[model samples]
Target: MNERIEDKVHFTQYISVPSPTSSGRSAAWLAKNWHLLNHLVELEATTLSVSARIEESIRGRMLNVVVHLCNVEDDTDFTELVLLSLSSELVKIQSISADYIEREVRCNLRGRRVTSDENDEILKEIMDALEKRGVRIDYS
Candidate 1:
């Protein structure tokens, strides 16, 4: 597989999760809605984290997230995007604020790179899928 760290695409988007939760609740919400994290791409290890912010006031809509995307690369190259995180990548995402989000979105581009428009489209699809799951996270 192509494992070039420099080749991966990395981007961050501030999003708002409508659940509006407090400490413990965020993780609980994430755990409960585990199936919704990556509705577009079902990757367990890649999407299992919700940072618990303990402060004077328990607020919602403050989710510091990291989302990594990967594509299906087979001989046929079907029309499917599978969410996957290698163990190494998992370690990095966990140590950071955005748990499980790394700069590792696998793709077979023959030689070039993923354009901005393409990236936007993919993100929109992901956000849309998440919205359908009752979790509205803006990708602005």
Candidate 2:
């Protein structure tokens, strides 16, 4: 079967989910809300990742977060914008600080480049769908 054009569009955002009291609770929250992340991935109608990692705080507690984004292409500008959009979606996040980085990788096929706002709109739609599911993440 021929692949759909929309399937070529893909993006990701690495968000540092704020520490929420306990690491267990934060983990639980992520587990329960995985659908939100999945829906966000579906927004682009392509593959996406919003994975997380936990770091030890000064207090020895873990700060749970998904700290990296992996898109098919190395479009740093577009990736950064998608992350900002995610922060806006999860209003509970008070702040987001990410060091933008870019890497080149060999790909089998060429892809069209997309604008930042267009990427944001896809993420917005994903967040909206999650909201209707009682996820209530703000994508303002």
Candidate 3:
């Protein structure tokens, strides 16, 4: 028996920001920064997700920003954008990292078996750059 397999790779980065007191301010801030983020990343199409939630601690509300990139080559540009955007005092950035990998596999028996490896070197370089900028990466 033989099997054929296909693999695909994807990278995702998450940013957690503390929301301001007023909802209006939060909305305005996200809108403005989202535009700036798109400009900085310079991607043909932006893949950014923004959500807000209320926190029980002194930090009233929090915004969770998720950026998904289909190409590993864009890792450096995305990380640099995160660094630039988070430098603002209005938002408190909790963490930023290339912490997620999505794999798509297709297989068929009676074909051929195959294996593949990810771009670990590029990912490692991105992680190292983020660490140097004081961003702790979560490998989950």
Candidate 4:
């Protein structure tokens, strides 16, 4: 038998609190704010632009994005990561276990061109949504 090696990238996960994680509530928030899509944002150097959208999927939906890394220089990027629906069993898991929790709803983690902003706008949006529901989250 051969041991399988997983291909991974350098990234972080969302860790929330209050005893058992309320992944269901968190996922609901994501679906509610999903309409914040179809946007064009430029990179720091003004040399790139990112186009993000939400596309329908069988498993739920995915964050579809594309980046013209060059603006004229190179081209690049969106990301996926399922956002398990509220009705799904995975959504009931705790938030701290990044791997165990149902990621049916998650922000784009793949940092392709790397935004120029000091803080990620998408993450901020998510945080705001959770705040409304009285859910506190920390990314680690």
Alpha carbon lDDT of each predicted model: 0.35, 0.38, 0.35, 0.34
Q: Best-fitting candidate, measured by TM-score?
A: 1
Top lDDT model: 2
lDDT of 1: 0.35
Rank the candidate models, highest TM-score first: 1, 4, 3, 2
lDDT of 4 by residue, 71-133 (tens): 434443323332222222222243323232214223333454445341244334434433343
Which residues of candidate 4, in runs, are more than 4 Å off?
1-44, 47-88, 96-111, 116-119, 129-140
Clashing pairs in 1: 20-60, 21-60
State the RMSD for candidate 1.
23.9
- The TM-scores of all predictions, comma-separated, are 0.25, 0.22, 0.24, 0.25
The parts of candidate 1 lying over 4 Å away from their true place are 1-77, 84-112, 138-140
6 Cα displacement, candidate 1 (Å):
30
- Tens digits of per-residue lDDT for model 2 on 55-115? 3345543332223344645535223222222322333434322221111111111153334
> Candidate 3 residues 73-130, lDDT tens each?
4534332111112332223455543333112111111131122222333244445544
